[model samples]
Target: MIQLQSSAMQDTQLVSNMMYFYSNSARSSNGRQSWILLLPDLITQSRQQTRVAVLATSMLLLAIQSREERIFVESLGYYCQALISIRRQLPLVTDPQNPDFLPLTCVAIVLSFFEALCGTLFNGYYQHVQGAVVLLQIQGPRNCALVPYHSLFYAVRNHAICASLMTGKISPLAGEPWLTIPFSLSKKSSSDLVNDILLAMPRYLSALNADETASETSRMSREDIVQDLMNHLQNLAGIWSQISQHEHPIAESTQPTIPQSVELTQRYTYDNPYHAKVIANYRTAHLLAFSLLSIILPCHDWDVAPFLDDSASILSAAGYLEECDIGCAYFQMVFPLRLVAQHSPCATRRRVAIDMLKRWCGEKPVRGLANSALEAIYRGQCVIPQSPVYRNVYPDMSTEHSKACCERPVPKPFSYTAKGQWIKLDGMDTYITGDTKAQRAVLWVYDIFGFSSQILRGADILAHSSKEPILVIIPDWFRGSTAELSWVPPVTEEQQQKLGTFIQTKASAAIVVPHVRTFAKCVKAVYPRIQRLGIFGFCWGGKLVSLACQGDALFDVAAQTSPARVDPEEAKHVTVPMALLVSGDEDAGLVARYAENIRAETHVEMFPSQIHGWMSARGDLNRLVVWNEYQRGYQVIVQFFDKYL
Candidate 1:
């Protein structure tokens, strides 16, 4: 009997060690503390059965730690025994109304963790997650107020939210009762606020997907839903701001606090590491919230500047976390950091975020989550919620520009008030704006939807915004073929083939280059005072700008927005200073690859929320979001010209 007691104590100690290893070392720690706290109760209730489960869990941890085939098999045997025992007790323990339901759920959660570690072919972990969700729904919030129950409830809720996002499925927990649960005022912390925001994410995603499928008549109501979500986000941001001002109240007052600093070295030796971790967590929440807001709000309504600012804060916080040797805290930040990496216009910040992700991957195997982060960085695309009206106007492009010029929205015509007169140049009608007597000149190239009022308005804004006196000229580059054409939905293969044929024959580089040169010479002849020259192109015109830069020295500088057919071979010959502004949805990998080959000083700026042709094709001029991006792109062009011309 004494020997039996000694053996039982040894097994319990082993169980304790395994619990510590998993809780402290695993990539995910949800519900781990709660399980640890319930260990004694579990042993007391069913010592033999609980010992088998604990032994299985310990062996699973050892298998992961050792990566040995023999140990993994041994762990599987112990797991099978525990699972059988649990199945026998399921009738009583799985009943949500029973007092033991929460404890049993915790046991199931831990077993699921072991199953995931064991490399189960089927998604065994998700089964456990779904089971927990059903139990929580049956138990309700009132029943979740007990010792281990509250923590388990939060852990399960959080896991469901994250799993739903990762799997691209609407969360089952995203129901009215779950979202409407009022926050406990006394228990409020930054973490709790973050949880509240995260719980709302699935509803937001559902609304966005719903808006995509809504009928035209109901689109306006859907827009209101998006607006309501935005207001909620704004309120959350306000609460976060208030919370960040104070040190985390839950942190012990006796612990020394380190002043927030950006220096990596100083962070490494900080007296109070938890204080820095709290700040990092707050920043992570802000980054994710703003990133989601940027997606949900219309491009014309969202502000990219503040998003950029928040991204910087996240990067700084991540660096602080890394240097403080609290990289586990930094691991929780990968998703938001990856969002910033894929969408931020700033190259340096994006690179830093990517590097951080790579570093994390190198540090530990994180079940391919890190790999997905790298993939998102390279792809540089995310779904943005849009109204059905907008969807009807601009459908998804089927192929790259090689097949056809990518489908773009037909911008509503605006009044072109810029002072300019049409002049015949190289057998084409040209509209000139700005000072005709100015020594410098800018040639504007139109896209497939040639010489629209929207393009003219953009030209007028450019002409007026430039600091120097210059003549702005718009050439009818499409030769009137595209004047009456607009994007019709259900774009077919035959239509794309015909469009590609037309581009190859009528608007190819062989045909457009000489005409552009003739027009340039004609402009110089008409205005002898013109010495410095620049070319600005949109869409199809962007290709012309590239051709002109490569084939001739007629222009000192060139700028293009949403350029098509910019092959890397052609980019190599670019000899003039060039500025390229592209949409976030464009192939960033292709652009970055081609930019490297360009011989001249090249600046490529990507607008995170803008679609192709956004600079000149947004139908709504009054939208702050669209107008802001338009103004920002225009200023970039103007600055590039002012510096080079």
Candidate 2:
């Protein structure tokens, strides 16, 4: 692995310089864009350089190399970055343009080379794979006028590739003795495993840097390279230590350095890197959703979901086989996977085993796994109705139907927002990520509501605004709210009046509530730096749109879809310039009475064919009604957001 990395690095400069030349000139000449004409020439060049990288990487692994190999890696890294940049500049094509082929071909080869080097250099660290995925993912959205869903999808795509590699699904090289290592799991925690892997790297690097054929070779000035690499390893080791410490607080940190060995056996002793990532992502998503008062899940086939292979019996059969810690604990709690562990006499082993089970199967926050957890470690306290959050808003909430299916209690504290081309006034953080492609986004989105989200935070109009920060409004008391699960009969005329008053009180509290109300609360604290606001919502959130409209007239414009129960009288209070998007069900007699007034009052679009929670339904197949509606609605929603706030 080390040898291959060394070899890949050998060609970085040469390849990067060539790519830069191609890119520097490719622009300003669409007439001359020719994949057929120039592609073969580039391939031939790649064929030779790739061979050098392969051999050099092999030599580096075997502990033999010329100083030349060391310089090669940096060069390769540079070129990969360049090719990534060029590919990003070209317009993404759906109809297969000629120029598209050229850039695509280059990106493929360039990324392959980059992956080879980074993969080998880092000893196949999953983070590098993830970074490589992100690097490739940023291309399309760079050309589009909206936020890049491609980046998100691309990340998942590469995740699949990496998963395959980790699982021994596909080999990087054919019929080669190399690429055989790092194919199994590591028994040591990832942090410990990293140190162990790096211990063997120096030897392969030494060979690659040394001139095996030069009998009298005495290499000098390579001190910096060696030190730089050691630094990299040390930094990685540090991160490993930190993550490990989270779960293993009681475990003593040892000074034992990872053994430096070229013949070490790869440990498939039960730790898959993807499992960790899936767990980490699950944890991150949980926090993100919890903070934003939303729910998120990885959109994929269950077969590919991390850790659990059988999918069924994940909860029942999964338990700890090893010692556990906070990191593992947090991971288990966050992802909806089954836990696997075993009872152990060994302390570390027992801890690990227990930790894994508790996390994946625990009930409190495992909202998604509630009913699904008959085989789980724990069970839900209660099962609520899968009704829309509009019961209080309508006399007959049955009019609007969204088949969300799960009746798990909603976590308390709710909020919503969308920032269309938001304006950033001054004094905000500047983050330059991926290709620096976002540089074209001079239009800052300061909208507190909507975000140009690829993650699909909102169940309504789907779009990404470059100007907006992800605006999320959280309702107070998210976990089992006063209104979260009311399995009551329809509101009576008298009850409707009473609840209308209740709605008024809630509305007044919301209207008057200060300090961390909408996502704008965060923005306001962070702003003067932030300017402009975009408001949006789905289901009951539509009501929030109305409330925000009444109070914040400065919100240039707002869009609401499938709103919750609205005070019929409050319709007269809406003052903000806005766009009202609602499903057919939301437009009723009284709600309908305000429709004309709403259209006259602001921008309004009614989707008569759609259900209220159409945006969030993850229906299996049946594209015409479910998928197409979401897609078309997403399109129009994006378009509407594109035109205004």
lDDT, model 1: 0.61
Looking at candidate 2, the ten consecutive residues that score lowest on lDDT are 258-267
The per-residue C-alpha lDDT of model 1 at residue 511 equals 90
lDDT of 1 by residue, 206-293 (tens): 5555556666632445466556557666766776575455333223233323223321211122224344444444554454555555
Off by over 4 Å in 2: 1-518, 527-529, 598-601, 617-622
Please provide, for model 2 over 59-147, each residue's C-alpha lDDT reduced to its tens digit, 9 standing for 90 to 100.
22222123355545654554455444544444443332333433343344333333332233332333333433333334332321122
lDDT of 2: 0.34
TM-scores for all candidates: the values are 0.50, 0.26
| TM-score of candidate 1 against the unseen true structure | 0.50
RMSD of each: 15.4, 25.7
Model 2 Cα shift for residue 379 (angstroms) = 23
Best-fitting candidate, scored by lDDT: 1
